[model samples]
Target: MQAVDQPERRATPTIRYFVRDLDAAVDFYRQLLGFEEELRPNPVFAMLYRGDLRLLLSVPGTYAGGHALPDGTLPSPGGWNRILLQVVDLDAAVEALRRAGVHFLDDRPSGVAVRQVLLEDPSGNPIELFEPATGYHERAR
Candidate 1:
């Protein structure tokens, strides 16, 4: 009998979203998306996690050292870039979210190997939800 030593993985995937209203963003992610609030160290910031994904919600504009460029350009939300989340049932998920008053960019679920729906957070940050179908592929573990 032997026990093989393995290094513990500490680093996790993190995504920061500049939000208009921190509380609303927090609620949207926490309530609908299943993210658990991890930390709220300050008034303008919050950290949340769902599985291995760590989502950082931040209020843009001036603070102490602000998230602004040297030229005084403040960071803003809403962009084409998005985080993809896998779901078991795309139709059910979309229905539930829509019933909860969530917004979607595409009117219908569409994809080749996967059915997908692009949804927006309270601050308009895009998040893609996909359900793998026939011909879908993923790297072997």
Candidate 2:
């Protein structure tokens, strides 16, 4: 047991994804996932947030050039791998997305304990919606 003189440690922040177009990404995330714009550094970059999770959108030729995506490309390659969001109600989420004109490559699975649906955003980046089994929930680190 040492003396209580050291400062407390802070937890690391959550991972943030960078997208191609700031405005388009903002629009897509806002409409699709109900994400709100937490901050906008400039016209080139914006931060959209949902709870503790954050997404960063950067336009071409801004900040780190390598991080910016190609201009005029709806969904540029190598921008994103995939994003997965857990939902409390899979059916409602799926139905809502469907009504919003979102297309899914695979519809909601049938008779599965853990329901899942696969779809893409406006930029063609894939996203997976998951409703875990009754006893399972994702824990934050």
Candidate 3:
């Protein structure tokens, strides 16, 4: 067969979270979520990755994406929209984070498929940690 070419594609999706302090945000994600710092080109921006997730941390007023709008509305962190991370043990994770002085918005079990909790980064950006229900693996297969 003739050779075919395909465009390069990222294996993981990158989500950017606007932060007030880049260093603090980096510490929070790195220490709490186990995200490793990938690249930091400057003091105002950083890249973190864990598993297949890539998180871009940017300080407002420093980067284009974190810049204020034409209407003078500045993009800030903290919102209902959040990134969900799956874990094998929700209780253990929650306990560990709690012991580390992390703040949680809420922790509750869903109907029959998931147990999840919402926590915040130093920038107040929300992150959801979830554990699948008992039969989830069997059902998924």
Candidate 4:
């Protein structure tokens, strides 16, 4: 019998969102959030990165697995399943995004625990930017 060893993981994995229009999605994220393209699979595919987070975009028929949603068939308004981003300064982030012409749905401070701003991307995906309260730590189960 052979013994197997699992490799160690260093950092938290990133989430990838698929978009119908890769170029438009990439441009929106890069311009609105200061993320840069770290990789381009071709003219039709690209990976944008900000800090430790990553977003992959591709044109139709470019990626395998999950099928693409047809035009005009996306989820209805407020049907957004949001992606959360932890930032050091919530206000500054919101201001920058605002200056870039990004629409903000809400920018409210929730107690002293977090201040968050909700915004939607060109593809109607919602993203939440938040600042953690002081002395906060992730609890282990």
Q: Report the C-alpha lDDT of model 4 over 1-141, residue by residue, as the tens digit.
A: 649664586654565565666677888888777678988867666877887777766554544222446763332223456778888888888778878777777766565566677887766667888887766555422
What would you estimate as the lDDT of candidate 4? 0.69
Cα deviation of 72, candidate 2, in Å = 17
Candidate 1, residues 81-127, lDDT tens digits: the string is 99888888889999999999999998488877788999999999999
What does the lDDT come to for candidate 3?
A: 0.86
- What TM-score, computed on C-alpha atoms, does each candidate reach? 0.85, 0.67, 0.87, 0.68
Regions more than 4 Å wrong, model 2: 1-20, 64-80, 110-113, 136-141
Per-residue lDDT for 24-135 in model 2, tens only? 7678789878788888867777777777677666654446332434553332423436667878898899898899898787885643457788887765667778887765
* Candidate with the larger lDDT of 2 and 4: 4
Which residue pairs in candidate 3 collide? none
10 residues in a row with least lDDT, candidate 3 = 2-11
Ranking by TM-score: 3, 1, 4, 2
Q: How does candidate 3 fare on TM-score?
A: 0.87
Candidate with the larger lDDT of 1 and 4 = 1
lDDT of 3 by residue, 1-141 (tens): 749764587458889999998988999889888899999988888989999899998888766378878898888999898999988888999999989888888866454678888898888999999988888779989
TM-score of 2: 0.67
List candidate 4 segments past 4 Å from native: 1-7, 60-79, 135-141
Q: Report clashes for each candidate as comma-separated counts.
A: 0, 0, 0, 0
